[model samples]
Target: MPRKFKVTVNNVDYDVDVLEIGAGSPQAMPSYTPIAAQIAPISSVPAAAMVAAAPSAKTGPAGAGDQCAQMGGVVVNIPVKQGHSVNEGDVVVELEAMKMKVPVIADRSGQVARILVAVGDGVENGQALLTIA
Candidate 1:
């Protein structure tokens, strides 16, 4: 594709046509290119590893996991269960994101009334992770 550019140097004005390289032009694309990449066979991964990759269902108490707060990543661990007493700053859940593990701590001293998410569940940046009651 050719892009036009205008430049002024000193008192002279110039218009230039620049040719873009690579894929910007439709002609650069192959007509028969596949719509998706082909995935390799999963034989290399152990069955246990594949199973561990999945997140489990929500565990412990019912009724909207109260005091839901936003946190993003995969629930890697739930160290505190429902009815467990905790103090402010006690780790309740551990999240894994971008190859880093982050511990979700108790915001206030109270019993963990519910564990809304289970291990392996994907979380959003502002989605509720759990509640303290």
Candidate 2:
């Protein structure tokens, strides 16, 4: 006998029939069939909309005094802006990776000189997020 199951993968839903085969049974194998009509189309959401809010300041090129990302991830928040005073170990940017939120801390105390990335931007390890001067 075949059992019907509804499965969702990557935001898409599918209806599939699954069969079971026992040892020493006459049937050599079990198969499954996915009903085309039951599948739900996957929808795309804009990256900017997925984040809490977009960065308010303009981003500039990387330069001296830049604070960098320690790991690759998507920018979730920017807690400091250009010209904002920050202290060493202060959280300046938040990143989301591997289903975890990571805080990017300031390496030195200084006024923010520049913002190099915005919320919803994907950053690589060691990439500059902002600059302290």
Candidate 1 residue-wise lDDT, 22-108, digit = tens? 767786865774544455468868899999997543433323435332456788888888888888888888888889898876778
Pairs that collide, model 2: none
Best by lDDT: 2
Candidate 2 wrongly placed segments (more than 4 Å): 1-20, 25-63
| True-vs-predicted CA distance for residue 13, candidate 2, Å | 17
Predictions in order: lDDT:
0.73, 0.84
Model 2 TM-score relative to the real fold: 0.56
The number of the candidate with the highest TM-score is 2
For candidate 2, write residues 1-133 as lDDT tens digits: 9999999999999999998777878786556566865665535555667574644323345467888888889999999888899999999999999999999988899999888889999987777888899
* Model 1 ranges off by over 4 Å: 1-71
RMSD of 2: 12.0
